[model samples]
Target: MTFASWQFAVFAAIVFGVYYLPPVRPFQVQLLVAASLFFYGYGQPELLPLLGIAVGGTYLFLVLALRDRRWLPVGIIFNLALLAFFKYKFLFFDPQAPALVDIAAIDFLLKLPLPIGISFFVFHNISLLVDLTRDKKAPLPSPTDVFLYIIFFPQLVAGPITRAGLFLPQIEPKRFSDVQLVEAAKWILIGFFFKLYVANNLNEMTSHMDFPFYETLQTQDRWLLVILYGYQIYADFFGYSAIAIGLGLLFGYRLPINFDLPYISASFSEFWTRWHISLSTWLRTYLYIPLGGNRCGKFRTYLNLIIVMGLGGLWHGVGPSYLIWGVMHGLLLAVERPFLKKFEGIKSAGFRALRIAAVFFCVTMLWIFFKLPNFDHALAYLAGMFRPSTNPNPTKLYYDLALLYSLPVILQHLHLNSFFERRLAAWEPYVYGALAALAYLEAGPATAFIYFQF
Candidate 1:
């Protein structure tokens, strides 16, 4: 169930009540496992077996590898193969191939649904095995712990992608302090505001505009739409991460921060570092470092960055647009590295602001490829932004609505950067109350988070 839904609200409330009861507290881990499995299987019961196989197989393989060490590859391959079969099958194979008509089994396999959160869970399992193999001194978690780590409901879907080492220790029961409860409530309130009010409203505003009509808009209107989309996606994904982290805290598990004001980043490399912090860390640790990272020569390092990012993009979806998006960032990063080094000594505030603006503009433009389904449509939209249009002008109402909706988020970013330089702790309660009221008054509709499709 989506976080914005009444169903999830009821589910969370019931789970929270049961979890904190004195008698039920000791069996918290088992209770959470059962709750998580139900959460994952609520919409698709058929996929429950797949999750079981992944959890079971990974745990078993890790156990075997502890003795033989040779079983490590076997474990890794098994998980990766399962991931590829579900995620990449449609991209790599044709179900209707003439020769496959005689083989009903092959066609059926090709037509299977891509399991929800397959990418996330597979990465978690892989990290578990890799860490075990790398650190022989580390203790192996019991199968129950392994299952909980992979299926914890808060992060089971779109995730901050917790590591086994960081998350496992928190499985033990702990007292929930008032301070922790307040902090979790604060995050949940902010998350609801972002998703229900900001992202959902923006989605409704732009829902009518499709590729066919995009070329008919004036240049100014197109740019405005593009800017709105940039913030919409940011709010949607960041909102999900905020809720996940807040829920993790409620459960006494500290999940990592996923975002850090990415729009203000001064370079593409810095952008990656700030945005999706957990996934980027995973990619660096698991994929980049193993491929020699920057330890190799400059050329190899550039190649590694490209390959890693390209795969990272493909990880999001098996689409040409996604690949192009990755390649664009990789190329920009490669070019920005030497430029950043040469200008490292520039300390002017004006220069810094200019750099931030330049980076933001570039990133916003690149988001065209990320948003559009077709590569050609993205290119056409970019072209429309440059060439003058004789089409009808967008109404002043549209501009005003866009500005009103977007201003709050922009002010939030400024406040985060210490622009006001005022202490907000004393006003925290009122701030939360204001956010909640705004969300309640302005919420458009219950909508799935953008990252859920991934």
Candidate 2:
């Protein structure tokens, strides 16, 4: 279930309630595993067996890899294959066909719906195998612990993509007294506020940016919507990550922090470091470093950057737009690399501000590819942004509403929240309470999180 849903609210509450009971303390790991299974299956029970095979198979491989290093690559490939099959199988075969190969098992596997978190959990599996097997001295972890690590309800879906080395060790009996109630409440509240009041509301305006509808938007409106979409996507994904982290804290497991004011970043490389920190970290550690990161020559480093970024883009989905989005980002990084040192030497505030604006403008413009996944549509929209609209009728966007909804994201990137926290220390709790009220009151029409498709 989605984090914004009332169903999830009830589910989280019930799970939280039963989690800390005196009798349940010893079985905390098992409890969380069961709860996670239920949470995942709550929406798609049919996929539970796939989930089982993934985790169980990963665990089996982990054990074998610990004994024989050769098996590690095999295990990693196995997980990658699962990701490839579920994520890209549609490119090769049509699931809607009544019958294809005449093999019931293969057909059943092909026709099954894409599992919601396959991308995330497969990474978890790879990380688990790679991290644990790197040190052959490490003992084999129990199957249940591995299961919990792979499918913990909070991050089982869209993730901060926690690493095996970071998360596996934290699996232990959690104490109620140790729960960070106030901290957790703040995260959950801010998450809900951003998702509801900001992202969902902005979605109403940005929805006009889609296909035939965007063709009806005026040129200026198209530009306005692209910037608004940048804000909306950040709020949506950041909101989900925040909720995941807060829930992790409530259960005494700490997920990685995902975003750190990415829009304000002055460089594309810095932006990657700040935005989706976990995923970037995973790519660096697992993919980049192994491919001889910057340790290789300058030319190799540039090639590595393109390769990683291209694969990272493909990881999101199968499409030319996604590839272009990623490759363009890689190009930005490559182009900026030689000048970054000189740019960093500058001390003027105006220079810094200009750099930030330039980076943000480039990033925002690229998001059009994400909004319009069809390559031609993305080009058409980009082309429209540069020319006057010829359409007889244009969609009227409410600029006031767009500004109101996007203000939070703007203020947040500026770090204004820190100012209020320090100056209004005594009023913090009450301020949160008001925001909670405002979020509920202003919440817009529900939309599935943008990252859910990945």
Candidate 2 per-residue C-alpha lDDT over 304-393 given as tens digits, one digit per residue, 9 for 90 to 100? 999999999899888999999999998899899999999999999999999999999999999998888899999999999999998888
Tell me which residue pairs clash in candidate 2. none
- Please give each candidate's TM-score: 0.94, 0.99
Off by over 4 Å in 2: none
RMSD of candidates 1 onward, in order: 2.3, 0.9
Error of 1 at 394 (Å): 5.7
lDDT tens digits, residues 181-290, model 1? 87798778888989988998888765534678785677877788888888888888888999998988888888889988888887788899988899999999999999
Weakest 10 consecutive residues, lDDT, candidate 1? 415-424
**Lowest lDDT 10-mer window, candidate 2?**
93-102
Q: Global CA lDDT of candidate 1, please?
A: 0.83
TM-score of 2: 0.99
